[model samples]
Target: MLRSGAGHPDAGQSEASTSRQLSPEEEAQRLYATLNEYLLLEHKAQPRLCLPNESENGEVTTGARDGAAHVLRCLKVWFDLPADVLINAISLFDRFLTKMKVRPCHVPCITVSCMNIALEQYAADTDTKRSISVEELVSISQSACTAGDVIRMSRVIVDKLSLVTGCRTSTVLDWLRLLRAMLRLHADQCAIVLPPSCQEEELVQLLEIVCCDAACVNTRTSELALVLLYYKLEQQLAESLAAAEESGTIPEHAYYLYDFARQLQLHCHMCDTTLAHARARVRHVLSRYERCEARRDQRQRLVWRLSERTLKVLRPTDRLTSLLPTIEEQHFAVDATPTRTRSGSESSENEETSDWPRSPVLPVYCDN
Candidate 1:
């Protein structure tokens, strides 16, 4: 739970005061830093969309690069992972192929496997509950993906990242952390779909490649992230559409496409569960901040009231002599009997005074 002012006195006072004191120049600098960080993440997460170089390489060679890039882009769109992540996955595939020497016919298999690995890692790390299982991974890899091809690619990616670097770099880790934060802000449910254990390494690899690429590093805004998301989903939809067409049951593929597309579309209205959850979490924190402010104000008012009452009660002690007359006045009434009558009655009054019942008696103290 978020702390209130009573719990974090300094945090409550200083932040509120500083927010008011911020100079225009200081505010501008803060905004610039935020926008700059967003742009860098955007650039790295999305891959270059150009067609593969065809002048020197044959159709098979060119086709392989194209297929891998397309698949990487597709996953980015479908899952809304950062562009850097997709780039990292593709680079992983490229590096693996570069070292092992695979043929063009193997392109689709490699591409699908790379995506599976990336998604697996994302889902596991973010969610405490709900993740894709090994059985599901195998099923997706064998059926929707090309005949168990991604299984080998998954192993290759894990081993290569482990053997090549031994550990992930600080830069990659930082980017992943930031991207996760951003996704949390937007509420990305890739955690449910991919899981942390399966995609952790792949996500790291994706971030590394994205950092290395100039186009990604130099990006100006989150446009890269957005475009990457759009293309990634489109690619998946196209592939599913093609497969359904091949099976002569395009309706089944349409159903798959519809489900995925529905998610992406829902995000447009800020309706997706992941994005909504992210928004709600932010609102929850802000609401706590507001509630703290309200409580502090109430406490201050109560304390001020108590202090005033204490002063009103104690202030008379300093002027006790001045207040004495008012106390006496409260106890007695003015003498209303005529002086002549009092004189005449005085002689007889000794007897009458003793017999008369005293009018309501007013007690008095002599002047102190």
Candidate 2:
């Protein structure tokens, strides 16, 4: 169980205020130190959590990990959780699964339980509404587990990991926030103002991609964020250069953006000496994104075709047969197609018929 005060609602707010009081250099140093500590702890935990070389139950398969990632993505979209919550939940889920043996039947419940724990810890300060309830989670997962099952699994996780619920993880979002603050405070030094384009939605999407990629698992969160920011800066610089070439004149702001990109490159080199690998990872991420975008239409068509073909072949007793209606059917049936009238002469009759009750009902008076 999470200890009292471990996830106090005000802790992040208070920490942010304290960070704001510090100089940019001091803040950077503090964040680097904190990140280092987290890296060290994670290194120590990794050995204990790794799957055995030869286990009776078998090793954790790639398919399982991919499935988990898929579930995390779906949950994030369905609940509209912030990047922090989703990242933290993924962290917890990965850590727990690495340490324990979970069967396919149990993965959905475990995934939901991790999200439930993360929501309890991190969602309090966000403007988003309360996280989805266990019932909703179960429905979303299409799992056999009831609400009580999820609660119980959560308890087991808490006890097994000795997890301090709400204890902050050094997630990519934390690193991004620190980087943003540092850049904002040292704007004079960087000689650039971060455009709104560089900050919110795009960065969130990048973080989501990085978090799900297996290649990035060993990378430090701060380093990963640094690499991502560097890529964005590089992109901005490239655009500026292209504009400058086309216009035959470089804008003053373009110089600042170039300087910022150079600074980012230097910082990234300092943070990770293996620039080749980091660049490769970034390229891989970009390629993956391109592929996904290119395949979007094709994949949608494939899914629709598969759904139709598979539905036709499914037997009444098939497990998926029960899921079809629950998964895709709407709760309420309504005919959305517009009703056509023969002419103006029939308008009055149509109105009269529409006013009639569709079903008989007993009326009762209620006190106001």
Candidate 3:
């Protein structure tokens, strides 16, 4: 929710000073270089492994991962932690798990420990106090891991990962921040508010899905983030175009969004050769997204059909009767002339009425 020049007291002044130091183009170039360096470092730090090797005995399994992911998601919702923190924690956990063998029994302790480390790192970055308590972390775990257990695990994780306490590694979040800054900078150039900040939560949600897939385990974080952003922007653009077509008018900011999407696509294609394995993983993520959407749509359609049938059944039969004319009423109205005969002729009149004007009765038979 924090904007570049909002919330913080000196944000505007700092941004102004920073802008004075470099042009937008130069700033973008610098960010690109920094992100590229981070990507290289990430690749060097952990190379991709084959899937069979990754799923060896003592390694984490799909079921364990799903359980851990569910716990993390619950913690995020319960504690109101930033998406960035949860993502960082997951990243760190996965990296550590890749190096060390972890049993299902040890997952909860390890998960909470990684989250604690991520919280510390994030707090250090933003110069904010740690908000979560040991009790809260322990309560979120599936197993009864005490604060002492979490502390010991944290230490082991830090030492094994060689993680510096105050410093955080460059992650997908960093890439997202850079992308937002770039879009904001360009939007300023065009005198528009084309910030992609609104999509941050969506991007994080997509990343969560991608992270769970086994194919994405070995994919580079930056590539995953970029591909996610690429698909997200494409979806947005498609929706915008449909709306514009209906309205017969397009917003000026639409062009800027489209341009940014194109840039994202170009970045993906340009980096395709270097991150060749990532393309398959990205495709897998997209397939998962599509399947999720399809299922959601299918569920909605089923509900709609059920509701429609219920409405039909609940409709007033009297109203339908009033709308439709019956055969007896039609025959009486058509052939019932005034009878001035005596009461003795009433029986014969009734007998004649039965055979009189059978044409109206034909409609009842046709209706049946």
What is the C-alpha local distance difference test score of each model? 0.44, 0.64, 0.65
The residue pairs that clash in candidate 3, if any, are none
Best by TM-score: 2
lDDT of 3 by residue, 1-368 (tens): 12222222233436767557766676666555554555555553342433243455666676576567667767877898887688778777777877786676788899899888888877876779998877778886655789999999999999988887555566666666555555666667788765354356666676766765656766666666666655665666677789999999977676675577458547644465645567666777668778888888557343333353455466522222212434564344566776675676468757645544322211122554
Question: Which residue pairs collide in model 2, if any?
Answer: none
Candidate 2 per-residue lDDT over residues 239-354, each given as its tens digit: 88898899898767755654654575565444445655776787797789889989888763433333534544652222221112235654544756555656655667676455
What does candidate 1's lDDT look like per residue over 21-69, in tens digits? 6444553344334434433333332333332345344333544565456
| TM-score per candidate, chains pooled | 0.30, 0.65, 0.63
lDDT score at residue 134, model 3, on the 0-100 scale:
74
